[model samples]
Target: MFVRTENFRTFTKLYPIITTITAIHLVLWLIVQFSENFLHLTVGYNLLVFQGEYWRLFTPIFLHESITHLLFNSLSLVLFGPGLERLLGKVKFISMYLLGGIAANVATLLLAPVYYSHLGASGAIFALFGIYFYMVFFRPDMLNTANSQIVLVILAISLVMTFFTGNVNIYAHLFGFLAGTIMAPIFLGKGTYTRSLSQIFPNMRRSPSTAGKGQSIFWIVLIVLVALGALSRFM
Candidate 1:
């Protein structure tokens, strides 16, 4: 499958932004061999989701089971990521990718049966799908050049494929998609990226202005916790 550049020019214009992030993740993936090996699904695999090894939730998105898995996922980055990056800008776009990925993996560890180990960019990709759905459904006017038809079509197919695909952790994808959908109103709102939470909340009636601040804090704490936990796992 391919998303044409002409149809998604807004996404194309910011291709380099997401490419840089993908490159950084590629490098990070190489640094941790264990991260590469652990983020997989099998008949039986044990993880420290609650006990620790929290980074396992994130590391798998950085690795690929095979070249084909990497190819399709990177293609998705080329296809959809640019548009999202354009919408969310360099910062939040990256945050969505990383956070969505982490959330999916962590949820798998916390919720899914231990007999299965989950991995892939599917959760993050679904995050994009869910977020776009929110924009088209709730804040269509704010989107620069969004196509409602395209959004609906993409979501419909994604859901159908989710049910049919055997290797994928559909549960994780659903959780990430739900998370992204709920969070979109905050990111899509006025001054989401440029302004602080305090500033946005006062003007905002529906969402707390501190929404942005809360997201920032969440990212910071998540990063620190993952970092410290991963370091201990390595030690």
Candidate 2:
């Protein structure tokens, strides 16, 4: 489910919302790179938020502090988003994404000091993981055994990294995940199980032996990318 086989045009056609949001990520990051004022205005600054600049909560969902930050979160959204988008439909999917992000920002506002500020879509990305986590236990029919294992392993690694890594927004990741977990039942009630990835690329189905290899490769590549992203922060 994590593998992407779609070409750019097909992918955009299939998952317009994901494509558009990723485009927004890129565009906003470029704008922020050149314009310090825009970055300050949109970043999730607790002081400004507490003083009634309410939009920070929402705007920060689309902003990132660096190119590496943008690429990591956007790559995550691209990899994991389409399945849920297909399952939940456009409206509910976007709703869950936004709610997860906004919830994280709100948590940051309440818990962090006045000087604290953050920018990225990690909160929303973790929210997607939260939904997958809920599926692994409660809605097993929605994901195959391989996908379930992938979700659990990746989530475990991510949570560990969240605490260990520097310059990370712990509040956003934790609360966004919580919000998605709580919201999953509401969004997924009585929905029929559908493997959107297989439907999109039926020809890519693999035998059990090859499937295991594919999963192993996926884990390796994803871990390398995540490690690079973490290391980039220090560099």
Candidate 3:
């Protein structure tokens, strides 16, 4: 289910919400890269948020601290988001994504120091994992065994890295994941399931033999990339 068989054009058409969000990530990162002032104005500075700059909670979800930060989150969204987006529909999917990010920021505000600041979609990305986790355990029909294993293993790795990785917002990741898990039952209720991408685009679908190998490779590559990305913060 995590495998992406769609071409660039097909992917955008299939998952417009993910495409738009990733575009926002890129655009805002570019803006912040050139303008430190904009970053300060928009980043999730807890004190500023407490003083009534409420938009910081939502805006920082799209902001990134570095090129690696941007790519890691964006790649994660691209790889893992489509399945949930398909399952939840556009409106509900976007709502959950925003709420997860906001919840993480709220956790940051309440739990972290007042001077703390953070920017990135890791919290929101964890939210996606939380939903998948719910599926693996509670809604088994939603994901096959391979997809289920993928979610569980990746989530475990991410949670471990959350603590060990430097400059990470541990609260955001944990709380965002909790929020998604709590909200999953509501969003993933009966009748929410939709046609898989393979069903919709028969011509593009891979044979089982090819798909199995592709998914294995995809999973390994994603894990390696995520691990390397987390480790790269030190280098």
Candidate 4:
């Protein structure tokens, strides 16, 4: 006779923040595959963006134009997100992801040709890569292990792909990397979490507010979107 016991230990190591975010992206893509209307609503349309559907700034990061796009970005997020989350903690990590994607979308909408639609989470993944890139330089300990070497190789391949690929949003990737680098000093700072946030935006220090660092990100994102949307009109 033989007996087998189920194993749940592996699941214990999974990062909930990364898993949940990935699930949402995959689920949204599934819906778009089945529903054309959703596909239309999700893509970053410049006209609709300026028309006050400011959500397009953030949502486009969740929308993938093709299955290949979804798979590549989803895989990158799943692989890179957990390590970053552990490094920065969940709240700040998610903020970086959102800010990266939003910044990339803003750059694309404003700088790319008008009527040029953009979508996909490569921007967010690039943000993660940006943080990793910073680590490779400033935080040498982060790349002390063997895993980091693999990540560096992966990033190099991605950079090459971004330049050669036709439909890719190169601008989004570039801006996302920049955004991540900008936020890294805060997320990976030496001080306490609150102090780190204050470094990111000095204004946060002025208010006697109860809002956490992550909550402040929403307001920052909103203000940036509104300001950029208005600026897009003039440009």
Better of 3 and 4 by lDDT: 3
Model 3, 143-172: lDDT tens digits are 875677667778888888888889999999
Q: Which stretches of candidate 2 lie over 4 Å from their true place?
A: 190-213
User: Global lDDT for candidate 1?
Assistant: 0.59
For model 2, the local distance difference test gives 0.85
TM-score of each: 0.66, 0.89, 0.89, 0.73
Q: After superposition, how far is residue 166 of candidate 1 from its true place, in Å?
A: 1.3
Ranking by lDDT: 3, 2, 4, 1
* Model 4, span 1-235: residue lDDT tens: 0011213344225466777777888899889889989878878988788888888898888886565566666656755676777777778888999999999999998888878888888788888888876775566555542344444555666676678656778899899988887888778863222222222233424454665555455345434433432332233
Report RMSD for candidate 4: 15.5
Task: Report the lDDT tens digits of candidate 2 across residue range 85-148.
Answer: 9888899999999999999999999999999999899899889898987887667688776787
Could you tell me the TM-score of candidate 3? Answer: 0.89
Q: Where does model 4 exceed 4 Å of error? A: 1-13, 190-235
lDDT (C-alpha, whole model) for all candidates:
0.59, 0.85, 0.86, 0.70
Query: Tens digit of lDDT per residue, candidate 1, span 116-167?
Result: 6655576787787778767765665644222454456556666765676556
Q: In candidate 1, where is summed lDDT lowest over 10 consecutive residues? A: 37-46
lDDT, model 1, position 78: 59
